[model samples]
Target: MGDYHVRFCESLGVKFPLATRLEAKQIEPGAAVAPKTYRFETLWMALNQTNHERYTETNALEQEKLLDKILVGNCLSFFKSLDIFVEA
Candidate 1:
C-alpha cells in the first residue's frame, strides 16, 4: 500500500512524507485466511499554491479539524466547498 501510494505521488510529482511498514503476524494453522503479505501506510500530499497557503495558514487545531473533515467526514463535499478538484 505504501509503495503504491509512493508511486502514485511520484507520478503526480507530489510529496510522499513517509512510508512505514506494518507489523506482520502469522496466521493460525487451518485458519481461513488470505495470502499474507507485507503492509505499509504512507501520507502523501499534492498541494497547489492556494491549497498550500490554506493549509499553512491554519493553526494546529484548525489543521486537525480540516484533516478530520477531509479524512473522516465527506471529502467530496469538503473539496466542493473549497472549489478544489481532486483527480481520483
Candidate 2:
C-alpha cells in the first residue's frame, strides 16, 4: 500500500508525505508485506460526506454542485484504477 501510494504520487508529480520515511526502511528478504485491500475507502468516505452535506444544503444549486463533484470524482477514480490495472 505504501509502495502504491509512493508510485501513484510520483506519477502525479506530487511529493508523498511519507516518501522519506518509506525510503529509510529496508525490508529483509522474504519479509511479509501488508495485506492488500480495496483502495477506495477514502473516496467512499468523501462521497458519504458529500451526500450528507448535500442533504443538509438548503439551496438546490448547492446540492447539484455537490452531486456533480461527486460524479466527477468517481469518474476520475474509476479511470485511475483502470490505469493501474493496465500497468499491472
Candidate 3:
C-alpha cells in the first residue's frame, strides 16, 4: 500500500506526511479476511491568503486528528455534503 499511496500522491501532487502498513493474523481457520493497511497523503488546502494553510483532509478518518478542527473544518465544510453524498 505504501507504493500505491506514493503513486497516488504523486499523481495528485499532494504531500504524504504519514505512512504505515496494516496487517492482521488469524490463529485458526475459517476466519476469512482480507487485511489491508492503506496509506494516506494529507494536502493542506490554502483557503485564503491570510493564513498559511487550512488542513483539509481527503480522508474521512483523518479529519479527527487536526489540531485546529474548526480551522480546517470551515475550509472543508463544503466537502461534508460530498462525503458519501450522491447528487440525484
TM-scores of all models?
Answer: 0.34, 0.37, 0.23
Overall local distance difference test of candidate 1: 0.61
Off by over 4 Å in 1: 1-40, 46-49, 73-88
Give me the displacement of residue 56 in model 1, in angstroms.
Answer: 0.5
lDDT per residue, candidate 1, 14-86, as tens digits? Answer: 8746734567798533323585653335443435567568778999998767655555345466666777655
lDDT per residue for candidate 3 within 1-88, as digits (tens), equals 6678678778989866763555679653221268545432444443343332333533545544543565546535555554633232
Model 2, residue 2: C-alpha shift (Å): 30
Rank candidates by TM-score, best first.
2, 1, 3
Cα shift from native, residue 31, model 3 (Å):
21
Q: What local lDDT score does residue 8 receive in model 1, on the 0 to 100 scale?
A: 78
lDDT of 3: 0.50
Q: Which predicted model would earn the best TM-score? A: 2
Candidate 2, superposed: residue stretches over 4 Å from native: 1-50, 84-88
- Give model 2's TM-score versus the native structure: 0.37
Model 3 per-residue lDDT at 76: 58
